[model samples]
Target: MEETKIFLITYFAALLGVVPPGLVNMSVAKTCVKRGKKNGIYMAFGASFIVLLQAALAIMLARYIFDNTYINNVLLRAGLVIFLIMMFYFLLMAQRKRKEVEVTPTSGFRSILKGMMIGVLNIFPIPFFVALAAALNVHGDIEYHLLNNTAFVLAASLGTFTTLYLYALFFAKIEAEGTYFARYSNYFMAALMLILVVITFIRIFSQ
Candidate 1:
C-alpha cells in the first residue's frame, strides 16, 4: 500500500472514530455550555494530547493490550465508579448553584489539568486503534514503525480535538438559551453520566 493512503486511512479512521458520543465530548459539552468555549477548547486540546499518546501505545501494544479482556473489564468498572463520583459532584454543584453563588469557569492550566485527568481515564481510544489495526491489516498484523505511529497519533489527536470542539460548540449554542441553562448544565451532564454508568454496569454484568 502507498504511504499516503495509509496516512489518510488513519486520519479519517480517527476522525470517524471520535464521532461517537462519549464521556470526553460530553464533558467538553458541559464545560462549554456552563463555562465557555475557550474552556471547552482547552479541555479538548488537553484530552487530545493524551489521546495521541494512548493511540500510539495501543498501536504498539495492541496484542498485549486488546488480548486481555480482564483489563478492559476493569477499566469499565473503574469508569463506572468514576462516573458515580462525578454524579455526586454535579449534585453538589447544583446545590451550590441554588444559592446564587457563581462557580468559576475552569481556564488556563486548570482546564488543561482537568482535561488531562479525564483523558487519562478515557482508555476507550485504545480500542479505537485496535479497530484501526484490524482495518489496516485485513490478513496480517499491523506494522507500527515510528513514522506510521507518528502519523496515526497526529491524525487521531486532530480528529479528537475536532470532534470534541464540535460537540462543545453545539452545547455552547445551548448556552445562549439563558442563565438557567448555564446554571443547570452540570446537572444535565451529571444525569447523562449517571445513565452511562448504569448502562456500563448492565453490559458488564451481561458479559
Candidate 2:
C-alpha cells in the first residue's frame, strides 16, 4: 500500500511540478500549433527522455545539497540567474523570429532536436525535483531503491508527456479553428518566462 501510494504521489507530484507555465510547456504548445501532433509528440518524447535522467539524478543528488544550507542558497541564487538568462534568451528569439508562421514540417528530426535542446536548457526544474526528492526522503515517505527510482523517473516522464500532449491538443484545437498561435508564440513564451524570472528572484530573496 505504501509503495503504491509513493508511486502515485510521485506521478502527481511531478505533474504539479511540471504543469506550471514555462518555456518547455510553452514550446510544446507552440510546436503543436505550428508544426503538427506528430512533431509535438516527438518533442515530448525527447523532453521526457531528458526528464527521466533528471529525475534519477535528482533522487541521488538532492540529499547532498539539502544537507548543506550554503549549497542550497548558492543553488537558489544560481537558479535565479539562469531564469534571467532564459528570460532574455526567449525575448531575443521572439524578436528575431517575429515573422514565424505555422507550416508543415519539412524536417521532422529537427523538431525533436529542438525539443531536446529546450529541455536541456530548462535547468529551472532541477532544483524543484531536487527539493521534492529531499523532502520525501526527510519525511520517510519514499524509499530509495533502484526499482522505485526507475518507477519515479517513468512517472515523471509520463507526467511531462501527458501535460505537453494536452497542451499540444489544446493548441491544435486552436489551429484547427484557423486561429494560429504560432506566429506570436515566442512573445507569449517570453512573457511567461519573464514571470518565472520574477518568481525565481523572489524565492531567492526570501531564502
lDDT of each: 0.76, 0.73
Runs of candidate 1 with Cα error greater than 4 angstroms are 1-3, 99-106
Report the number of the highest-lDDT candidate: 1
TM-score quality measure for candidate 2? 0.85
> How badly does each model clash, as a count of residue pairs?
0, 0
Q: For candidate 1, lDDT tens digit of each residue in 1-207?
A: 445656778777777777776778877876776568788888888898998888888777776656677876886788788888888887887777365423357656788878888899776687777667656766675576777777777877887887888877887776666367666767776787788789879967886
Model 1 residue 194 CA deviation in Å? 2.2
RMSD to true structure for each model, in Å:
2.7, 2.5
Residue 165 lDDT in candidate 2: 76
Evaluate residue 64 in candidate 1 and report its C-alpha lDDT on the 0 to 100 scale.
65
**Weakest ten-residue segment in model 2 by summed lDDT:** 97-106
